[model samples]
Target chain A: MIVTEKQQLKMLSSAEMQLLHEGSCSLLSRVGVKVTHAGIAALLLASGAQCKGDRIMLPQDMVKNALAQSARIIQFEAPDPAYSFTVNGPENQVKFGTGGQALYVVQRTSNGWVRKSAGTDDLKQIIVLCNQLKQVDFITRPVECDLPDEQKDVAKAAVFRRYCSKPINLANLVKLARLAEVLEIIGNRAHLSFIISLVSSPLVMDSSAGDKFVAIVQKDIPVAISSCPQGGSTAPFSEVGELLQLNAELLFGFVLANVVRPGAKVLYRGIPITANLYSDASPRWCQPDSIRRVALAAQLCRFYNLPCCGTAGVSDQAVPSAQGISEKVLSWVYEAACGGQYINSALGMLEQVMSVSYYQYVIDDIALGIVKEKFSKAQSLAISQLALSAALEVLGCFGIEPDEKMEAELSARIRHIENGLEPYNETYIEDQLAVIEKAVNKSSSTVFMKAARKGLREGYLYKGARLDASLDLAAVAERLESSEGLGT
Target chain B: MNKDELLEKLEHSVVMGHLDADDEGYDGSMEGTPGTLELLEQALEAGIEPQKLIESFRVAMEKVGNLFASEEYNLADMLASAECVGEAMEIIESKLQVGNSSNKGKFLIATVEGDLHDIGKNIVATMLKGAGYQVKDLGINVPAQAIMQEIREFKPDFVGLSALLTSTMIEMEHVVRLIKEDSFPDLKLFIGGAPTSQAFADKIGADHYCRDVMDAMNKLEQVSNVS
Candidate 1:
């Protein structure tokens, strides 16, 4: 619990937290999210939500009520506490958590489809960066891969096997079911909060997607509910209005996830951005105001007595530029403020969360360090009076009017700063960068890669674990046709 | 070419990157004629060069990049765009050869073995080309010795190496050091990928890091000025 001055200014109060919660709920119920999966819609209809065809709309009060009931602090420590992190509650400081950092990150990726490249490291950098930052909650897609590249989507999903303590928000559906099937791959050791996705098309869940959704239920997987919508795209353009649409859609996803995997956990997820013209190619969620607003919106998930997952930190810059810094910070800060339980994307991600950069990842870690210093809460004084006295004497008494003595103290303090003093140290960035290298080189890769490879070799998690090693040929052919035949 | 058409082809080329399409281009193929350079020149001669052509290629491509914001285009589009840009670059490249080459310095680019993704490598190449450097791309999944061999033969001012995988990013470091330890002691090596960092660069002793195109340009300019 290291607190800093900047953190003190940014801390949210209980009442403020509740207002945010209510506002988010009001938005969720009034606007309502689309339910893409029909089966999910049925589940919500069976619940208390209002049914409109496939769409199950939630009421404003219902959203507010749900927000109030949702769990605020999720003690995320595993039964083995050693590799655990407490999914922090609001008021307890934190940054944001991202879904993942993929191999094929982009400066701009909006459409659901992206030409998959085998083993893009840009995504990996995001995972490491998010992992390096204290504010970020999850580290995902920690590796590269081979083949037609789309299965690499699963690689983003696959890294979860290595990070049980930090539950991963993998691409929902089949991957979720596969994760459940391979629970032993992770040895039931890690806590995985599965992402059960719903439609942005109101409230209908896809039948096939539902089958996969139900697989999580069958496995009794802990699921998080999300109905992400982009204005004029997956959702209407208005922020609150869009939230309402998603609320209904998400509620359906939640009910389906829980009906199958009863007691499966849920975390509300959303995007606070505008859309580009006719194409769904890009979503503008990085505006500072939008990020802040989304932070407030994520509190509605808390209304459900569940943890919240709010995304931020995707930049359009392929490298570490002012734009990258701005998008990354807005995203991270919003998630932290929203009191999200799982945060990712503090590193190695760019564009609309499409590409990754190793160097940029290093730069992101540097930014995270700077931001952490900016937001860390100041702890109570536990040091001795002697230390306090010496610390104070170094730069005190120079507050208002700088006299000769004050000038002398300031000069000495400046020298100390130049020489790497406490509070204001020398290029901690260099140290930070060094540590990043070590983390990427010495630590993160060697141990986990071996595990991931071994995990898949020994057999990976799949939706219908009827276990078909014989299907290798079909998979290969399917891969070849998608890659070569499509004429990309 | 109109903005839309230019963007479409440029996006295609970037997605379809080529490292060894070597030609001392006395031709106009790099102008993206959808075929080889000989055909590309014919396309360019139909009147493709303009400040608008250059700047708009970047702008339209970026605007096409708008798909990234609300989750429209996705990572696949990005890869496609990157490859497409690579193709368009080929076309632009031949034209560059025809003009007073921007190549203030010569750079060599490659990917380490078992690393097939070329997104980062293409970016560096394009940026270097944009900044007026004569870049020789070695393509994806290259071996360390190949780089050393390339250096021995070509004697480039800077060597840019990329590895898309963390497992392979490690190999980049080893090769960077190997270039110094075994051969090309004077080679200015730059390493990038998702896993390698500035700290990694310093620890492994890579002379410089091209954090981005602009940074690489500035770094190259500075390096040349010093020499």
Candidate 2:
């Protein structure tokens, strides 16, 4: 786990937080939320909410009760229990993972980088890469595959089980009904993690998304209501408006999820992207404005006593160039310093979350290791006081120089810290490439077949055996075993 | 007020983003002076030339762009300015023709399909209009067929495509190909956005690659002069 030091910065004061909370509460009770799913509307109405058409005005007391039902600390279980991560409470740590639903696979060519439509092999390769990278604590469907639209969800489930053991966080790209089929297969498995429950921008939950969340909650799965409110378009142009609307949306989800299953694991996932004033398009997440907005959202989540999910380290560059490096590094540093228990979209994504690169994934894993070293470790105040007294003693002696023994000791300690620092050089990347090569070599026919058969089992492993022709698991294993190399 | 004075106030209103006397400017000031739309009415009632009024609108919008570029203003400021220009243009569109048509020509712009970003597109449209070109904005998520339809009906001298997302930027190539294959062979085509570059323009067979709104204006002027 990535540890953090005590925070010395506060994005919002108590009064400001109180005002925002109260404003959201008032908005929830007054303007209400438009829930497109009739079942969810019925649940809210049965629980003392007033409904006018699609809008459901939840009572403040009911919202508070729902808030009270949240889990302070959510243990995200992986297939291996050692890989599981907690959401909030005393963890005070950050975990990095890949996030995107991009259709393109940005591959390095002989000339330069070129973006091509991602195939199932590309998706499987991402899972294999993340599985070996220790920095990636969890896995999400990083890139969209080239499977037919109807077969998307089952394809993801089949591929995810075949390669990865880390907890999975799924996007909302799959059709709700098909997504339910996929989830039912992984529902009882030890590796099944939370789903990214998305709500519409500006306080509206569409029919399908509402039903999806309800089904997810019915399965007793954890849901993180990740809302993306672009500053100028879907949300109000002002920062205040963005903050208020984002908070209101999350709170609305919190209420809805609890109403579906009280005490369900719900995380407040806020992704506040800033719009470029000239184009009204969001720049990369590295912008100071975007970071600041996310920090405020984290602070609001803290006030509501809800776990926060955030995105950082994504770049708008199409290639793994200097621009991509700087953007990803700056964003990781900012989010690490600020607040976020689980930093989504922290690796392997580019072009504003529109593409993923295998080379970049390996490079980003190395970059995150460097950034995590800067995280200050927690120390006892008494130990700090003793060090301070020693400093004072040295200061009391003014111009007196230390002996050679003392000087040597100080130099040794400095060297220790310096030695721990690993530069993200070419050799490091080559080393990671070697690791990927080793991983590919190990995907033997026997190992691949075993995992495939286990994942394709009845309700215990997966549901619905409507496998696609392109996803021939045995053929994929054969191809990987016989291919020359990844051609990195 | 005198005609020149009224026009000046109209320009100031656009720069300040005062839609009307009732528009509370970005600041707390509610200067009771008539806004750009209202002052345009006053200037027209005073029998001021429509081209002259449009010229003032152009100047004000340019200031808005400059302020935004310099970081002195923001989205709300430029949007307010554009909204003001839109309101005034609606009033004088019938009376207005492309002013100084000997020097400039009409331009059609759109954000290609699958991209819902129009802020950059809006900036270019407003800047082109202010630069004395009759601009038709097709707004966001415009399919290639729709853009081709507009090109046929509007017969613009230039077609500009904007795409903020890389996924949607691919659509620009399709749009460009369709336009080239269609009857509009002489139609000058350009592309711009956060993800677009000169290399992309070359690969897609577009005539010009604009880095920003200012670059777009400059290139359009150069192309207009050459053509």
Candidate 3:
């Protein structure tokens, strides 16, 4: 899983990263994050964060101290012991895991693709299926249990304990009160971890997530303080603006994590995806624009030398197809090449985290294997070459031949990711910050969407030609049929 | 300039999504000039009729709507124009006589309990206000009790509920049930959010399921036309 320096994709130079870090610090100290939890606010205030109305502003020194005090190497222990791994901040190792809070389970039927409501049984089946998938290094709770709010945490933990042997990431705690019972059911805190979106977009902290984060960190459990800001919606439409806000939000989590428990095992999870402003403002997960921003986020996380929990391969397509496979391959390659140590949502996700398909799981396993193989065999090759080659090979395996138009589209995508769309500078960052501040102050993302009017007219989002060849899903179907515990 | 010229400027400013003299507006260079607010105030000071200003707002918003539909403007441009009309309506309402104002039907909007998402709700509220409706924005994480209380007090003709999280969808259904159980039979319930669909609306007994801001506007317009 280690990516060599030659194979690494460096989207931002050190100077650019420094500017982004400085901008993040400025945002934290200036705009600040709204902390609704009084106790957390008090804790932050006591820890050198100034109180500005409802927001708690972290100074540069405070943020730097928190960064220094955070754990550099986070050990993700698995129940099987042999599957355990450690994510070192300075290492180039990348691990892929299944992750999502998908509401539906998609399956290919004789009639068509059927999407049914995902329940606790689907959680068990997914865990069992992923346990056998060699490419799945760890297992994240992909779907929430169909239980009452109070019972969900414990019920989901029990299901993972009984079915999964890999490192278990109960993505989020539904109820903080049930944490004790959930941990007791799992029986090993070492084998367990959690993901908390402690801060909402535009620097607003979710009170419930804050409470859960405090409890989990206090328990000495490894957690990924995640922040996903959809550009043109909750964040600025520009990549620079979105990254500044995203970095600020994640840094706020790190400061709070250190405040809660010094050296708290927290990974930097920043997914700076864009909103589909051309239509419904829903999040575009694995589109080319999102792929670029997410890869940039990974690179930035590496710049901070933080344990990176990257997100990729969450396909935007509703069903598994050639376009989905191409998107997943490119996303996985770029994210891994950019130093994502512990990648999540790397398999089975579809429809922008709305659904997970069983067939898609096997397909992702194969496609990811192809990607990792390409990365490992790569020598003196740029990330763009690795991505394009891997994507073409993966698509060819899926019975998709990239026509000239599609090849040109893929080449353009690689070029775009290789060369960023926006300039990372002081003036640009300040303007982006102003847009975010406007959105936050007004409590509406219309400022961002309005700001994006020009960009949309200029094709800010990649409108590439899709690979329309019908996917030969025979291998996927065979794998799904032969896979154990899928109830197929 | 003259009153007619001032009115034309005000309308133009709204269409350009300018708020005040400080606003950069659509093209980001219109700052430090007479924007919608400044122009409206000047027109009013120059003895322009409030009804005439209202007519200008309607015309400007219609143009903005067309721009948005044609992809020349986005949600932000539309919202900016709507905000101009919304703020102008507040000023113009005071100038007009009681019950003779150009106000449309009252609309109440809120994100359901346990959900802190407000972008969708805020956009809908601003757009409704721009469309000449008297909108009451209850904001995010509003509990069912608070929403019901607001419904009773506001007596809105339409109640729009929003919840981005599936967990809060239940709360949305609960809010809808509470509203339905009340005596306000003429109140139309509209539900929206990522998880909401026509099926969910039907199951929860909501009168309509808005897919997005445009969908909400279209449904509201249909009801307005029917009434």
Candidate 2, superposed: residue stretches over 4 Å from native: A2-9, A34-46, A50-56, A88-90, A103-117, A184-190, A193-197, A232-238, A278-280, A316-330, A333-338, A376-488, B22-33, B49-51, B62-77, B93-227
Can you write out model 1's per-residue Cα lDDT over A387-434, one digit (the tens) per residue?
A: 223222322211222246534443332232112111112242223223
In model 3, residue pairs whose N, Cα or C atoms come closer than 3 Å (at least 3 residues apart or on different chains), thus clashing, are none
User: Which 10 residues in a row give candidate 3 chain A its minimum summed lDDT?
Assistant: A451-460
Name the docking class for model 2: incorrect
Q: Each predicted complex: what DockQ?
A: 0.02, 0.14, 0.51
Ranking by DockQ: 3, 2, 1
| Pairs with steric clashes in candidate 2 | A279-B119, A279-B120
Off by over 4 Å in 1: A1-81, A88-98, A101-137, A142-180, A201-204, A217-220, A255-263, A277-281, A302-305, A377-488, B1-227
DockQ of 2: 0.14
> What TM-score, computed on C-alpha atoms, does each candidate reach?
0.45, 0.69, 0.96
Compose the digit string of candidate 1's lDDT tens values, residues B44-143: 6656553434553455346534544454533323333333334445567665555534346778998888564454565457546644466788876688
Q: Report fnat in order of the candidates.
A: 0.00, 0.12, 0.40
Full-model lDDT, candidate 3: 0.89
Interface RMSD of each: 18.2, 22.5, 2.2
Model no. 3, DockQ = 0.51
Model 2 chain B: ten consecutive residues of lowest lDDT: B94-103
TM-score of chain B of each: 0.58, 0.82, 0.96
